[model samples]
Target: MSKKERKLSAAEQRRKEKFLEKCSTMETEGYRMENLSFSVLQINLLSVFIALPVNFLFMFSYFLFNDFSLRSVYLPYAPLLFLLIFLLLIVVHEAIHGITWGYFAPDGRKSIEYGVIWQALTPYCTCSSPLTKKQYFWGALMPTIILGFLPGIIAIITGWEPLFFVSQFMILAGAGDFLIVARLLLHRPKNAQVIYLDHPYECGLVAFLKNID
Candidate 1:
C-alpha cells in the first residue's frame, strides 16, 4: 500500500495563508522579522533561575508589610487533593494565555491555537495574527500576574500558604514570558509599529516591525 498525503483543514489553510500574507506585506513595506528559539527544558530551567529573586521579592515584601508566621495548611488527606488542584491550575494557566491573547486577536477566539509539543510534553497557546507590542506583552504576562502575583499578594495579606505556594509556582512557570518581553524591549525597532507572532512550536516568538509614515 502507498502512503496517502495529508491535507490541511480549512482553518489551518486560512492560518497559513494569513501568515504568508503578513510576511509578504511586511517585506513590501521594508519590514524585517526576527525570531528567538529555545527548547522546552531550556526555557523551564531558565524560568526557575529568573523566578527565584522575583518570588523572593514577593515574599519579602509580604513579610515586610504584614505579620509573618508559618502555619500548616496541609491536612492528613490533602496531599492528593492538592496535587489534583495543582494539575488543574496548570491547565488554567494555559487557558489564561489563550483567553487573554484572544481578546486582542483580529479574529478573536478563532485566532488562538492550542497544542502540545509531544517531544517536550509541553502545552502552548499561540496567536495566529499579529499583535501590538503592548498587547502581546499583556497576553504573555497575564497568566503570571493573575495566577502568581495577584494570588501571592492575597496569600501574603491573608497568610494563606496554599495561595502563596501556588502563586510562586505560576510565577516560575511564566519565566519564559518575562524573557520574551525583555528581548522585545531590548531589540525591538525604534519608531515602528511592532507586531508579535507567537511561534507555533518553539519556546519564543517572532517579532515584525514596520516603520511609521
Candidate 2:
C-alpha cells in the first residue's frame, strides 16, 4: 500500500500495517508478497466489457430459439414481485461470497464480514484470512455459477424469461468478481504456492507466493 492509499482510509491503513508485519515475517520464511489489486475505476470499467459478451451470448442464443419474453408465466403483481426478487438475489449474491470464503477462512466464519458501499450502493463480502488458490477460486466464483450461469443455462433451455433475465443480470452484477478471478487465472506465479487475501479498500486481492521445494 502506498502513502496515497494509506491516507484515504485509516481503518484500511491499520489493516495494511498489520499485514505488512505479517508479510515481513513471511518474507523471512521465504515468501514474497505483492499488491495484486486494481483500482475502483478499473474494476468498474472492466465490469462493463466483461458483462457484454456474457449477456450477448446468452441473449443471442435465447432469441434464436425463443421469443424475447419477459412474462413466461403469470404472477400476482408481476412487476412488483420481479423487483422484489431482484433485490433479494442481490443479498443472496453477497451471502454466497461470505459463506464460501468463510468456509475456507482460517478463522472460519469469524473472519468473514458483509458490508455495503453506500456511495455506489454495492454490497460486498470479504474474508480477512488468507486462502489457498483452490479455495479462493471457488469463493470468488460460486455466486456466478450458482445464481448466474446455472439458472441462465436452465432458462435458455427451458424458455423461462424471468429466470433468464435474473440470471443474466446476476452474471452482469458479478462481472467485477469475474475480473478478479480472471486475474488469478492469468497471472499465477510459476513454481510457487500461492495465497490470496481479500483487499479491504478495493475490489481486488493481495497475493503471497512461496517457491516450491
Candidate 3:
C-alpha cells in the first residue's frame, strides 16, 4: 500500500481516497475502526518467519512414517511443468480468498477486485464489502488450508515428494494471510459491534467497530 498507489489507475486512486474519507467519517461519528494493515516489507518478512514452523511441522509429520534418508530433492515434473504449476497455484491462492469472501459478501463477487503490483509481482485480491469475524478469518486462511495443509497431509501419507514440497511453499506463501488473521484474533472490542473490511490499498483489513449505547 505504501507505494502501490503509483501503479493505481486514476479511478483506483479515487476509490482509495473515498475509503479513507469514509474511515475518517466513521471515527468522527464515534464508530472508529482499527487499522490492521501492514506494509509490504512487514508482510514479506512475516511470510517467511511465520510460515517456517508450519512447514517444519509438515516435514516432521512426513518423517514420522518415512525414512528421512530416502527423501529426494528431485521433483517428478520437468522445469517447465513445475514453473507452470507454481504460477498457477499463486493465482489460485488469491482466487480462493476471492471466492470465499465473495460467497459471504453482500454484493457477492462484484465486491472483489484482483490485481498485481507489477513492480513486486505481488498479486492481491481486495474485498469492498465488510464481513463477520468468522468470514474474514476463514477467507484469509482458506488458501493455506486448502493449498498447504491438506495437500501436505495427503502427501505425507502417500509419500508424494512433489506435493509435500508444494505444500511447504504454499504454506509459506500464506504467511501474510496468517498474520492478518492473527491480528484479528488478538483484537478485543468491549461492548462494540465489529466487522472487517479489507483495506483496498494495504495488506490487511480494517476492523470497523461501533460502540453500543
Candidate 4:
C-alpha cells in the first residue's frame, strides 16, 4: 500500500485499540462506554436537549415581560443588529471559557492571549490554566452551556431574533467544547494531563499546559 494508505490504516488500528481499551476500562468501573465516542448526532441531540427548552422559555418570558424588540428600535437596521449580536455572543463565549478555567484552575491565575495566522485569517484565543483534564473539560463547557440558555432566555424576553441567533452560535461553539469533553471523558489518561493544540501559527501558546503537582 502507499504511504498515505498505510498511515490511514495505522490510525484506524489505533482508534480501534483505543476504543476497546476504553470499553474495558468503563466496564470495570461500572460505566457504559456506548456514548463515549460521541457521534455528531449524539452531540446534536445533547445540545438540543440542553439548549432548546431553555431558549424557548427565556424568549417567551423576555418578550412577554419586556418591551425590547426590533419594533421598538430601528427595524430597518435589523441586519446590523444581528451582526452585532452575533459578535457579542462570540466575545461572551470566549470570555466565559477564560473566566471559568481561571477561577477553577489549580493556580487560579490563568491567562488569555489572542493570536492570528496567515496574516490574520485564522484567529483564536488561548486560555492557559493549571487544571486537570476534568477541570479543563468543565471550564470549557461552562461558557457554551451558559450562553446557550441565557441568550435564548434574553431573546424570548425581548422578542428579538438576534438573541436567538446568539444562542445558536453559542451552541455551535459548544459543539467544539463538547467534542473536547467527549475525548477527555473517553481517554481519561492515567497521568491526568493537560492538553495543547498547535496551529499553523504558533501564536505564542508555548506554555499552554503546565504540570501541576
Which residue segments of model 1 deviate by more than 4 Å? 1-25, 62-76, 211-213
Model 3 — TM-score against the truth?
A: 0.89
- Stretches of candidate 4 off by over 4 Å are 1-75, 117-123, 153-160, 189-213
lDDT of each: 0.75, 0.81, 0.84, 0.51
**Highest-lDDT candidate:** 3
To one decimal, what is the Cα RMSD in angstroms of model 1 from the true structure?
5.6
lDDT of 3 by residue, 30-123 (tens): 7777888887668887778788988888898898986654334554655566677778999999999999999999999999988886656789
Tens-digit lDDT track of model 1 for 1-213: 013312444554665577778778888888887775455666767867778999899889777776655443356756676677777877888899899999999889988887665555667787887787788889988998998889998988887776787788788878888877777667647688767887644566777777887
Give candidate 2's total backbone clashes.
0
Q: Worst ten-residue run, lDDT, model 1?
A: 1-10
TM-scores for all candidates? Answer: 0.81, 0.86, 0.89, 0.49
Please provide, for model 4 over 24-142, each residue's C-alpha lDDT reduced to its tens digit, 9 standing for 90 to 100: 65457554322223333344456455555544655566657766544523567766876777677677776776677667655554344444322323334445433455566667678
Which scores higher on lDDT, 1 or 2?
2
The count of residue-pair clashes in candidate 1 stands at: 0
In candidate 2, what are the lDDT values of residues 113-194, reduced to their tens digit?
7776555566778788999878988999998899999998898899888888889888998899889888878866789887
